[model samples]
Structures are given as C-alpha cells and as structure tokens.
Target: MTANASPRRWLFVLTILVGSFLLFLVQPMVARMVLPKLGGAPAVWNSAMLVYQALLLGGYAYAHWLGRFQIRRQAAIHVALLVAAALWLPIGIANIAPPAPGQEALWVPLLLIASIGPVFFVVAAQAPLMQRWFAADTRAGDPYILYAASNLGSFAGLISYPALVEPALPLAAQSWGWTAGYALLVALVAISAAARWRAGGEAVGAEAVADGEARPALRRQIHWLLIAAVPSGLMLSTTTHLTTDIVAMPLLWVLPLGLYLLSFVIAFSTMDRLVQTITVVAPAGLLSVGGLSLLSSGGGSMMIALSSLAMLFLVATALHGYLYHLRPAPRYLTLFYLIMSAGGVLGGLFAALFAPLVFDWVYEHPLLVLASAMLLPLPALFPWDQWLGLKPRAARWTAALLVAVAAFACWKMVDGWTGVVADVKWWGIVIFAIGLLVIGWRWAFVPVFALLMLGVGGWDTVQESFSGMRVRSYFGVYTVTDDPEHQQRRLAHGTTLHGLQRTEAGKQLEPTTYYGHQSGVGLTLDKAEALAGPDAAVGIVGLGAGTLACYRKPGQKWTIFEIDPVMVDIARDPTKFTFLSECAGDTPVILGDARLQVANQPPGRFDILVIDAFSSDAIPLHLLTKEAIGIYARAMKPDGILLIHISNRFFNLEPVLAAEAKARGWSAAIRIDPSPTGDDFSDLTGSNWVALTAAPQRMDALTGGIRPRKDSRNEGVWVPLEGRARFERWTDDYASTLPILFWGNIIGDRE
Candidate 1:
C-alpha cells in the first residue's frame, strides 16, 4: 500500500515471473537433450519430474533458511546465489556417457544434477523470496497473490516449449536462448534487492513476526503435505494414461504439466468465484472420469485425453484452493512453501520411481483418484440435502441397495454376464444417481465410487492382472491374453497392440500383426533369399513378441536387437508367444538401445535389417534422426534393404523419413496394410512400413511384387516417397515431432 511501494510491486512480480519461466523452460529442454542417450519411453519424463521436484524442495528450504537474516543481507545472499548459479548457464545435459542397462532410473537424476541443478535451484527460490521481500518493503500487502503470477509464468514456459520453442529452434539455439533469459532474470533480482535494502533484522515475513502470529502446528503442516501430494502424483499418472493412447512426445508431455501450473494460478488468485466453481465440480468429475479411465476409456484418444486432463485440473484446483485458504500469514510463507515442495517430491517418487517397480498396470492412477476423493472438500450439489430429511433416511436403506446393484453390474461385466450388458447401464445410472444424494458426506460416497469402479472395470483387472497377464519395465507395461475363441495369443503395450500369433497347431509358424503377408517388411522378407542370397544375414530392432521371427528362411542368420529385457522375456518365453520360442529361439538377442547397439556392430554386416520398435504407440524419435540413420547405414551392406515399421496411432512420420532419405540420396517407398473387419482381424493390424536403400536395384526387388500402377491399384505395393516443404532435416541436435504429429489422427477417430 504506500504509493512508493506501488511503483515497486510489478518489479518484484517481474523478477519472480522471469525466474519461474526460465526454471520450467530448462526442464523439458534438458530432458529432450538427454533423450537420445536413454530412450523415448514415457517413464523417462516421469523420472525427470522427480528430479525437478527434488531441486524445488532444496530451493524452498534455502529460501526459508534465508528468512533468519536481515532484509539487506537476505537480498544480498540471494543475488550472490543467482550470480554463482549463472556459471552453469547455457544449460544443457552434462557431458556424461549414457547409462548402462537397468541404470537409467538412478543415473537420470545424477545427470540432471550435474547439468541444471544450481541454475534451477536459484531460480526456484525467487518466487517465495521475492514475495517475502515485497511484503517487507511494502509494509502491508497480500504477497500470496504474487504466487499466482509466478505460476502463470510457469504455465507460459511449459506450453511455449512444445508449441513455439521446439518447432522453431534446434537444441543448441534453445540452450543459448535460455541463457539470455537467465541473464535478464539475474538483472531483475539485483534491482529488486536495491529497492528493499533495509539495514536492521526486520522481522517482517520471517520468524518473530511483525503481526505476532504463531508458527503453524506440525499436524497442520503434514496435512498440507498430504493434500499437495495427491494432485502431484495424479498429474503424472494422468500423463502416463494419456500418452498411452497418444504419442509420447514433448508436445503431449507439456499439456498436463501446463494445466497443473495453470491450476496454481487460479487457486492462488483473487478470483474466488472460479476457484469455488471448480471445487464444486471436481469430486463429481473425479468419480466419473476415474471410472472410465480405469476401463478402456469410454472412447478414442482425443476423448480419453481430454477427460483425463479435465479431471486433473479440477482435482488440482480444488486441492490447491484449500491450500490457499489454509495458508499462514506472510511470516510463515517460506516454511509453507517448503512443506509443499516436500510433498511434491514425495508424490513424484511414488509415481515415477515406485509405481513401475511395485505394480504391473498403471495401478497408481486409480489409487490416486481414490486419494483425491478422500482429501477433497466436497459440498452437496443442488438442494438434495435441503429437500431431504429424506437423504439421511434414504442413506440407511439405500447403502445396502446400492451395494447390491453394484454387485449385479459387476457380475454382468465379469463372471456370468459373458459380454452382454443390456441391463448394466441403466442399473449403473440408477445406483450412481442415488449415490449422489449423500454428496456432502465423504464416508458414504467413497464406497459407492469404489464399488462402481469395480462394476465398470475393476473386477476385470482383478481377474486379468493376477493371472500373470501383465508385466512392467522402465519402457512400459505389457499385457498378454489368450483369445480362446480364435485360438491366438495377443500382446499389447498400453492400448496399442504390438503383436499376436495364431496358436492353431501348424499355423503357429506364421507371422502376424504388423508383419502380415502383404506388409512391406513381410513382402521383403518373403523374397529374402532372392534379395540377399541363400545365406542372407538379417538384423531386427525391437523384438515385440518376435512376430518378425517367423519370416526367417531356413539356414538364414537372424539377429534380434531389443532394448527392454522385459520384452525379450515376453518374446522368448514359449508360454507367451511361440514365434520367438519355436521360430527363432536359437538366434542372437542383444539388449541395449537400438542406435547404440547398431553403431557397435561391424560395418556391412547385414544384407537386410528391419527396425520394428514401439514404446506404447510412440515413435522412437532417436532412431529416426540422421545420425541414427548413418549408424544403421554403416551396419548394412551397400545393397542392403532397411525396413522400418512406421505404424503409429498418433503420428504421420512419412515426412521425417522422406527428408532423411533425401539428405542421403537414398531411394524409399512405402506399403500400407489395412486391417480387415472379419475373422482374420486378430491376425492382422493396419500398418505403415517404409523401405529404404541406397542401391536402387535392392528397392526394386521388393517393389516388383505388385503389378504396375497402370495395370492395378498399388495396394500392398511400395509407393515411392519424395521430400516436401517444412520437412527439416532431422539430426541429433535438431529434430521435432510437431510437423509430423498426426494432429488429424489424434483428434479424429482412431484409424
């Protein structure tokens, strides 16, 4: 409030805003920098989040400790820290070598610490530190509102990286550009310091408060931690769930995180109405969306992704609104933020470090949803409680009735119903509508939500999960199920079907799914002897149930390169997929990243090589870069054929491949295999396979299978590719999925 302080208010706000922006911008940038060294699995982003949270906790603790110093000393110390951290600027991943297999989990944090630890720490402290300084200088103002501005800047940074920064600039440019922003942030922090240069140890916004307010109790601080942890863990779980259907690229990676930061904006703002409205809607959305998320997600990629994000925003806003409401006076502000950061680290560890090791499915998703239900401040919707003395009366009798109805629906979905659900929908609606009567009451509503979740899909997981049908690794979760009706065993990663094999006695020897007989890889392997001669050598990347193994010619040398050991086990086990066990059990299976492993191989080793890899329907960005292509080229003979399975649910990668081919003057063509709607549906999947070769004669051998285009349609034939505009050359330093993200495919129906 003083006129002198009014002029300085936006100065502190600017300092906090700039610092927070640079902090978040570096997170995704550095993660992308390290991506090639590891791999493009969704878990990689989750691990990166754990590191960010750990650093944030340290920053908050540092700010809280600084509160004990005099105002001028506090400002001086923070500025000194900022200048010191700047020595590590032009932020990039450390020059460390890639981690060994099974070492990615622990090694990721160490790598990040070496690279951006000091920069992120000093920047993260500015939000709380600047606000406290503003309060001390202004004499009286709610500095907490500045927290809203800080997160608003964070939302901007997260969103802009994927949308603007990444598509327009390369990694090297992005790094130097962020350094410029850090320099500006440093200047702003110094100006703020001069404006608040108080000499004595003024106890404003610090311990021994100016207002005589007591420190918050230990029990209450623990409550704050629990509340903050739910949304933190739930946000990561939602990201995993969404990317399972969409592609696991940075574009989609930023959406949930941006929303999470945006939630903090609303929760800490002066806009009470928006916060109240979201609080009223959050619990209901949690139950409804939570149930569908646990199931096959009621619809396509777009619908599931939208609903899950909405659920996260609503839950985050509701819980953070309560945090803002329970906030201590300005004296304990730093301590409050310190506790909140600790909770964030707890949640990230649970989801990123703990979940993959503990459970097979994304079991944390449902559990976090349940945790939200328990912690949220739910109020009754409509006048149901007002209209009813009847609600309390009904609660006694209807609890039993609702339980019985839930059990019946569970039966329809599970044991006796056997795929028919004619009556289940109406029964579920009736039970849910009745369950809404006790909206204000927590104890009654949670059971109804839990039982309804079971009826919808929980019981299916119970029966399906414990029977050894699911497995998890750093890459993703794998589910295996036998289709007794068709006599085929199936393998899936997330919602994407990776491979399947027929178990009909002698038919088990055939290859299926993406490698169907009409597929490009299929057509090339069929003519393997003609193209590479009798003793042809073959190398394959990504052993997904080893479906491509059955394509082997007798006495041909076939080799498998798989990154995930879990996938190796799934394919090698005779009990899982018979293709690898019976067809290529004796072949070599190398375990490591495909690019690195292929680079280590001797030059001109293979006559034919196939790249068939998927991390939950996402394209491996590292494998498609120019350097990676060069490594692959070195491993193959001059006349060798490279078959890359480019099928993806959320990206159209033809342009990227076309540009790579153009840069090297290699000839390339594609085959599109359409899945049928009939009896053979289980045995085939729609796919896009591109074949590239430096030698034109090698490509001609596979393209020769179909009649000329003048005589017939080029169905199952390799169509030639040419580079188009906006097709930037994809190198290790410069690559983006934005131009090729299949936006229409993600928003439209699943093709």
Candidate 2:
C-alpha cells in the first residue's frame, strides 16, 4: 500500500468512528430529556433502538444511491443535509407535554421521532455511507475495519452515558454536551469531505463492473440474515433472561448489551486471536453458565451468576464480529446491512413483542442459549480421517454409550439424589468434562449436555414453573412455595416483588401478599365499614393468587378485571390458593384489558377499585391514559376511592400520578410502607398505594380512618382527568418503548 493510501484508510476509519460516537451518544441524551415525563422502563430503550435502526437504514439507502454522484457532488449534498439537521438543534425535545397518562404506547414513539428525527437520521447514515465513500476515494482499502470502529463508538456511547455522562450531569446539561458532540462530529465529517475533495478525480467514479464480478447469490444473502439474526436476537434474549426471568436488574440489562457492542469492537478490530479465543470458551460457558442461570438464587446470588453469563454474550458478540469481518464489499455493503438489519429487527420483535404473546414462558432466554450453542464455532476434537479409523458401527455404539450414561446420571442427580447428596459435586464435574469432550468431537453432544446440564439445573427451574406452583400473567410471574416453618406465595414482576403471602389459619385467606392486610389496601379494607357498607361493590383490576379475596366480607359484591386469563386460572384453581374459594366464592373474574372491560361495565358499579394491572415490567399506559381514567371514574360511585399500585423497580411513577392529579381535580394522598424483612405477620407485608377520589370528604374519611403520619411532600395536587387530553396516549395501536421511563441521570445537567 502507498503512504498516501494508508493516510486515506486511517482518515476513513476516523470519520466513521466520530460519526458513530455522535450517533449513539445522541440516543441516551434524547431519552434522558424525555424521561422525567415518560417514566423509565426497558421497553422505552427498546423503542429508542428501533428509531435509531430505522433512521440508519434510511441513511444507508441514501448513501448507496449517492454513490452514483461525482465525489464533489456527494460531499456537497451531505454537507447540506448536516447543516439542515443542525437547525433544529441545541438538541432537545420540543417543549411538548408528555402524552396524557397511559398514552405512552403511541405518544412516546411519535414524540421521540419528532424530537430527534433529523439529527438521528443524518448521523446514523454516516458510518455505512462514509465507509462506502472511503472505498471510492482511497486507492485501496478494505473499509470494513472502519465498520469495527463505528461499533466501537457505539460501545463507547452506551458505556459512557451510564458511567460518565449520566453520573456527571443532569438532563439539561446532557443535551448541551450532546449538541457539542454533534458539532464535533460535523467538523470531523467536513474534514473527511475536504480530504475527498482534495483527492479530486482520484476518487474512483462508479463503474458498471461485469456481472461475473457480482458477489454472493441470493441464497448466501439469506444465509447471512439467519446467522446475523440469531445472534442479535440472542443478545436481547440474554437480557430478558437475566433481568426478567432471572435477576431483573439494571446491571444485567446493561451487561449483555454492552458485551454485544464490545464484541463488534473485537470482531472488527485488526485482532483475530482475541475473537477466536472468546469463541472457543463460548461453548463451555454456554453449557455451564447457561445451566447455572437456572438455579433459583433469589435476587442476590442470581445477580452474580448473571454476570458470569456475560461471558456467553461476549462469545455471541465475537461470532457476530467474525461475521462483520467477512462482510461483502462497499458495492454490496447496503445489501449486507439490509440483511443484518432484518435479523436485528426480527430478534427484537421476538424479544419485545412476540415472546410475550407466543409462549407463556419467557422463551427469549432459553432460545438465545440454544442459538448461541449452534452459532459459536466448536473445536474439532480429533482429525476427521483418524476418527474414521474406528469402525463406523463401533463409533456409533460409543456415542450411544456416552449419551445413555449422561442421561442416566442426569436423572439420578435430579431425581434420586436428595439434599446435600454425597459425591454430587464430583459427579457434576465429571459429567461436565465428558460433555465438553462430546462437544469437542460430536455436535450431538451439544444437545446431550445441553439437556443433561439443563436437567440437573435448568429443568428444575422449568419444572418449578408448573401451574399452582408458578404463574406467568401479562402482569408478571407469581410463585407459591412451601417450607418447614411457613408456606409463602410471592408475586414477582421481572425480579421485583409485587406481593408476598403467608399462611393464615392453614388456609390462604390472608390478604398480605401484594395488598397484604398491612398494606394501604389492607388498611382501607379493615376500615371498609367507614369507607362503604357491607354490600358495597368492590373491583380489582389484577387478582394475583386471589390474595385480596380474603378481605371480602359477607354479602359484599366483588369483581376482578384481569387481562391474562392464565392469572385468573392460577388464582382460582384450588391447587394454587383458596383465597377466592374460602373467602369470596363467586368473585367475578373478568377477562381482557382493564380499560376495555371497565368501559363496558355499568356506571356507578364499584365503590372501591384497586388498579394493579402490570405485565412483568410493562406498565399498561393505556390503562392510565386520560380516557381510561374517565371510564374508571364513571364506573365508581360519587364517594368511591381508587387505589393505584404503582410499585416498579426502574421508575419513580409518583410524578406521573402527581401530574395526572394536578391536571384533573381530585383529592389524593400517597401512603408509603416499607417491605418487612422479619417473620412477624404484621411486619413482613409492606406496600405503596395512591388513593384518589373526586369527593374530598370521602378521601378525608379514608385518611382519617388510618394511622396518621407526617405530611407527604411527594404527592401532587388532585385534578380531575378530562378526556384523553391531547398529550400522547399509549394504546395497543401504536406504542414504542424508546422514550425511557426514569431516564433521570442520562440527559442533561442534573446529577
């Protein structure tokens, strides 16, 4: 390569690197700005990714089309686009109020696009486009190394936002910081364009190469899509498994995504050895750590094991990186990326949308593990020809022996073995070693140990997921377990506890789970006489294990509106819990979304409605929208009170409720109770409930009936919810999780 050629290649890499950094940094920066209004959640981040990818595809297509232009013309056109995008900047959302309560499904995505569309679209395209330009301008270069740099910038952006930017600044300052970064990116692009302009006629013009020069056929492109899609999907799947299915913590979510980005860095860099080494270790880790993920360590140890699982993610990343290394030339770059994007979108759809609908279980996690095992390159145990030295029949018999032994040992370990069984550790270690050998020589051993390890560890978790023992509703998973001292039933939404139940009088009529007797719901129910008469009609939006049914009094009418029929079945079945059978034998369990169900209900029916509908980490914004609020209000009596269970791990929803209360005239107060860690019946149950009422006198009655505490500064004003006030309303029709909920520290100057 000529000295001048080397300079051109480096310059190309630098341009892509700068462009990528700006591209990714802008995402969190914009998300942070809207978080105070949007609320924080994983879905918000997912939606943001979609926005970035969509705009990226658009930019790449534009760059591909522009390749037909003379170098000077392309530069001029791009510079104009950059300038036009900057006009809307200082980089922030427009001064628009958030979608009305519960409109997040629609308004959040729309608002995100409106706020950052131009800037994002322009920046996102630069990587693929600039690399193609480099291939045109540089006398000779791969341009793919620059692809690696772009992803490195992406990794830097994701890591820097949480670790450096968010911790250092508030939302407002973050916006300015990003604006500064965008200006720098613009400067970098200008420098490259200047270089290309100087290169002048040397910038190779597009040529119609012979059809013989064409690359992979359509079949190969489709193959590339599957390879790319599976790993990309697995990355997200790992996140779901770690957080929702296993440990549901921020670190878990960030680790897998971080590793994924880092993998691209390793894959694209001039380092082949690092990528190869990670892939070799990947298979062993997938089998071992994947099995470990199945162990129920509650919250603490599960977090540690989840971190270990990051190794598996790194492996997947390495494999994906290898794919990029083999990526086609600039002429076919867009096609390669188009396929890549399709895979990414499909994976995301499965994780975010379809998985919730298709399987009652969180299938993403296991599916990802399976995909990783298939994709990661396995080590060859022996020479192919040497293996043939053994008779074919003998080889087959030996393979069968290994399988039988592994299967039998697995069965004994799980079924025959009891607590703290002797030799269990050694046995497991030996089995793992044999499995590794099998993975080395035979691909069949992959599934063999996959099932073996899964059985000894993973299958246990799966079996524990049986009906009556465990429940997965749109809201989340609820588990009931028994011990020597006491029996307990717990409700968990993505690693966060929603409710817990303790044995009462040998029958589970204790309303001490999520809405335990000690909770705000319990406190109100205890004073049911003062709030309403015995025949008062009570409504509950979510009926988890029927814990609240125990609070029913004789002749009192009760109804439940639940979206997931599975949850109702779990709670009502005698095997799960008898909260309904023993308390309210005829508790009307209504199915479907609460908003639609409540709208269809008779007006002035419920005197007290407890709103507790949530699917795992999903907060049904539709249910809380202004329109839904009106339906709720209409369904209740004049003096009725509404209890909203707003407990979530990732967001501070109080402000949202405060905004609603301020917008709509109503009397409201927040009751705060910490979860009990002790064994005492009264001490173990805790909850936070917000009570709203149009009648101040009625709210006063409920408040007066409870133990008085210090005034709350957090609770905002009470304002009646008008119609679905024109803010964004999140409906099933249109929802994007991009505008992160509680993206507090990531945006501007606030720390």
Candidate 3:
C-alpha cells in the first residue's frame, strides 16, 4: 500500500462499489423467488424489508464488536465469520413449515430468518466495516467517498432485480446465480481483508480522546434512530399509497424505493454544493405539498407531486448526510452504522408490522411528512423573531377565519374519492398569496398553507376516507360511490380492479359493475336454471357490495364467505350495497377466511362457488394452496364448478391457477370479457375469470351457453404451480407476507 492516490483510490472505490452492489441485488432477487410461496401482496414486501433491516442492524452490531479488536484480529474474525456464513450457501430458504396451523403471521418471519438470516447478516455489515478498514489501513484518505460507492452499488442492485434477474431467470436458477455472487463476494472480502492485514503490525489508527468519560447520550441515539426510521418507513408507505390508490402499474413500487435509494446516493456523495441547495428547498417542499397524504388522491397534484418527491429526496438526503457528518471515527465506524441499521429496522417494524395492527389504513406516510418538516430547519421570513411582533392579533384572527373558509371550500372541491379536485389547478396562486401574507409567523404560514393544500386537494372528501365510509383490509380498499341513477360499490387494491356492484336508488340490490350481465359472473348466474335448476345452492367468497346476492333465484340457497367483518357491515347497511336485501334477503353471510370456512363445509353443499376474495394487491396464498383446492373440490357437487376472479394489478396469476389444476388432474381455462365503454356503469368493467372443474361434463355445461371470445394470453412462461406441494403449504399452520411480492405489470391490458 503506497501513499499515491491513483491506484489505491480506484481499488478502494471498486471494492466498495462491488460489495454494495451485491448487497442490494440479493434483496430483490430473493424476494422475487419467494413470491409464489408467500403470497403476492404489498405487506409481504414490507415484511421482507423488515428482515433485511433487522439483519443489517445485526450485521452492524457484529462489525462494531469486531472493530474493538486489533487490525489483525478484526480481519481474522471477519474472514472466519464470512466463511462460516458461507456454510449455508446456495442461498435458499429451508424446507420448513410452522409447527401449528394458522400462524403464518408469526412463522413467516421465523422461516425467513432461518433461511437467509445468516447470509444477509454477514453481507449487510460489510459496507460500514469495510469503509472503516479502508480508513484504518490507509490513514490519508476520506472514507466518505466510499459511502457514495456503496450506495451506487445498492442502486445498481435495486435496478437490476426487475430489469435483469427476474425476467432473465427462474426461481431455482436465480438462487444458484446469487450463490455464485456470494462466493465472489467472499473472494472480494478476502482481498480487502488481506489488504488490511498487510498494513504493518499494530495498525491501531487514531482514537478519540474522552473529554468526559460518559458514553453517547440516549437522546442522540434515539434521534439517529428516528432520522433513519422516518424516511425508510415513509418510502414504504409512499409505495403502498401510490400502488394502491394512485397508479397500479408495473414498476410503480420500484420507483419510490429507487428514489429513496437515490437520496442516499446524493446525501453521502462528496458534492456538498448540490446537497446544500436541495436542503434549502426541502422546507418549501414540505410546506407546499405535504398536505395531500391520502392514498386515494393520486400523485398528479402539482404541489403534491413536486413537494412529495422533493421532500422525500431532500429530507432523506439531509438525514443521511447528517449521519455521514456524525459518522464515528474509523475505530467505531461499525457502531455508527449499527445504530443506523437499527433505526432502519425500527422504521420498517413500525410501517410493516405495527401499522396494520394499529391503524386501519397506512398512516406512516403523513407521520413521515411531519417528521421531515420537523428535522429540516426553516428559514426566518422576518428579521424579528418575536412571536407577538410577527403578526397583529386581528390579522392572525383574520387568517384563522380565512383558513376556516378554505376548509369549507375544500369540502366543496372534492369531486370523488378517486379523482383530484379542481382547486389544485390554482394552488400555486393560492399558496403564493398566503405565503406572502403569512411570511413571519411559523404558525400562520404552516397552518394556512396546510389549509390551502386541504382546500386544493388534501381535505377534499377526507371525511369519507376517515369516517369508515371506506374499508382497507389485507385485500384492498372498499368504497361506496354514487352516480345519477345507480349507486355503486367498488373494491380496488393498487390499480387492479377487484370487485364491484351497483344498486338502484343506492339501496336496491343489483349485480352491476364487473358482476353485471356482461361479466362472466353474471352470465353464469343468468343460466343458473339450466346448470343447477331452480333452488340451486350458490356460494360467493368476497361480499363486496353484496352484488352476487342479486343473482339468487327464488327457493335458492345463497351463502357467502366474507373475510373482513367491515365489508359485511358495509354491505348490510342499507346506505351501502343492499344486495342481501334485494336479492337473497334471508341468506346468511359467513364470516372468517373463505378457504377455511369452505374447507370445513359438508359435501355437495353448493352447486356453484364464485371466488372474489382479493382486495387491493393481496392474493391470499392459503386459499390457492393445493390443500385448499382439495377442499373446494370436495365441498361442491360432482357437477358443480368454481369461478376464480384473477383480475389484479401486479401479477400474472393465471399460470398459478393452471399449474394448480394441472397438478390435481383437473381442467382449467380462462375467459376474458372486455369492459364496455359507456355510462351504463354496469357494462363498463373488464374481468379475467378462470373456471376450474374436475368433471368435463360440468366444464362444458358452464362454458357451453356463453359465447366464447378469444382468450387473452399472458406472455410470461407458466410454471406448474403445484401449490404448497413444491413449497410450504400456506395453511393455518404457517403463512408469510414476507416473500410473496411480484410488483410487476399491475395492469395487464386495456379493455
């Protein structure tokens, strides 16, 4: 090792870059491989993130402990640990299931840890520890640039998962490929460790003198945790909101996370001027568009789009930059990173683990926004800092009155739960005017600007989003909407349209929306007489708006299996969808998981069962498992058929159905009905329906009466999904939302 900067600097950069790249690359690749086994849902990604964060924190802690040793000892321990972790190589989860049934929430995390835990923990600590080693081995260079290289590697990995690894390889092949990369990573670590070892005996680098023997303050440590946690949690929350409420397209989730990673790149880079500029603008960004935190409102709001992206990038960069500024000396570098990693893990726990149980919907987004505002220092608009002299009492009162008026204006501005308001069209003019008048006082500016955002976009129809008028479950958000003649109820998870129904005078039960006459559900029910004769037994899984109830004929037994009680409550309320009242007035809606309930039902219980259980982006893996299919097969009569609704924003699930059927020796074919373009509402929705049947006679009977349109083909390769046979059967025993996230192509094709 020489003092010359040329070769050594390049070597340092290359090592950091490669290590970081491999670290981030594995995160998405492994996640994609586990999708089918886990279940494709947003919450699954959140869980996987938690695992990554937690492992990262652990790795940092390990690094911190190792750093306390001599240079040779540190290198020796790292080499040994890396080799030890490699023993569990070939990078795949263990073939293990939960000990008891119905414990997926608990078991998924444990399975994930058992599978990839050791491998990830070792790799995660490398960035911080390696940079410290570089600093200690070569005492002349600034290690901050290595941080930039590390993030650059991370950015590459995140980008590569969707663009290269997933599309290019299958799940099994991906595991082997990642294993090879892990081997290469081991070699790279060896090289770095060798470099450190060669740096002469007793390379004890400089140590900080203790002015006071006290350890770091508890408040500082908590602040570090908060700073890292807020942005990381918000990044996930933003992705959840955008995918579910804003736009449910492919690459949408990656965009927010990519930007989040990009923030770290900018924050840690040597370009101080750029960071300074962005930080200066971050406050204005937070105040201007921070109000529209609703997932229902899409990201096209000028203020929101700009401010949200800006605030996220700026605040994230600022906080990360602060972490870099307060970076511990080389002696304690791992400790600093350990604290940062812990913060990241905590953030994920709050967003993915705690929020779902606590808040009915995603509250992490607004909470993050408020946190960003507090962390960013504001510029003084007036020379006088005095609260009293800032603005006159009468003027302050007038401002409050104006805000109240604006709140009224906001109430009027909201067009629908789904669409943005018109007031945002003139938001710049409004915010600018308010900004001019409320310059000096923090309270005056913050509240009024927030009010203006509310009037323009934020508070519009918020009462509905909050008043339980909408229901967000593991499935998606269910809302009741009204038009001129017909009142409609819709369920959307991400951009994928799940289920919907219409009502006459907002109470008369009618099978509208996708289940209308034009839909396959409607067609099947319309010919119920020929299929099963009068008084046939019928079953529907998802009770959204209870539209399927309208298809019940006199003397027919109509049974529904609905998961969320909130949905049942909404449909049962006269103000919501009254399919139960207008259709099957006396029928009972069964509560609990549909598969569990149906699996336990007696044989020959139903002539037909329609599965419409998905909400938002969550596809219940348990319901689709092979064992569950056996239950469905047993529950229905020999002549009965099952209709599965596969319309989703982010996955190509037809293959899953096909594979399951193939494994069971049952037959399955898909039907694609295009949504009609008109104001009828009943005919204006698209659907992908897969009909499964064991008996050929029943299959023919089901599809014979309806006209067959050309089937829309999914271009991706269809692997045989022998559900739970190839992997852990998601049962009451064990399930996970950790690995089943395929955020690709949320919307398939235009109707």
- The prediction achieving the highest lDDT against the true structure is 1
**Model 1 Cα lDDT, one tens digit per residue, 60-120:** 9999999888878897888888889888878877888767767877887788899999999
- Score every model by TM-score: 0.94, 0.70, 0.77
The C-alpha RMSD of each candidate to the native structure, in angstroms, is 2.9, 8.3, 7.0
Candidate 2 lDDT over 1-751, as tens digits, reads 5766555677677778778877777776776565534434444666776766667767766776766676688788888899899987888777666466467567767878888888888887788767766766545466666778888888788777767776556556777777887788788778787777754422432332332456768877776777777766777666666556554444345667677777777787778887777767676776666655455433533435455556556666656865765576556765676677677777777766667656555656676666666666777443342457866666667666777777766766676435566655556665676667666544566666565556555666667666436655434455656543666655555455555556555545556645755567877777676678878789998876677888888877889887666667767777656777778778788875677678779999988988987654455565665556778999999889888987654445555555566667777777766666766654154456888888888877777633334354222222222223332333222222333355542222111
- The lDDT of model 2 is 0.66
- What is the clash tally of candidate 1? 0
Off by over 4 Å in 1: 1-7, 97-102, 138-140, 199-210, 245-250, 296-301, 389-420, 677-682, 705-714
User: Which candidate, 1 or 2, has the higher lDDT?
Assistant: 1
lDDT of 3 by residue, 1-751 (tens): 4655422556667766776777788787666556545645455566688778878888888878877676678878787888898887777767885337556666667777888898888888788777777776445365666778888888898888777775556556777877888777778777777776756422323333232334557787777777888888878777666545555444556767778888888887778888777765665656555656643445332233334556677778867776666655555556667777788887778767777666655656666776665555455443332555545666667666656655554445544323544444554355545544554445666665555555544554356566765666654555555555545555443334444555445445555556766666787788787888887888998887677777888878888888676667777876665567767767888876687678768998888889887764446655776666778888999878888887664555665676667766776666666666666555356667777877877767766633333334421111122243343333322333323444333323221
Sort by lDDT, top down from the best: 1, 2, 3
In model 1, the clashing pairs are none
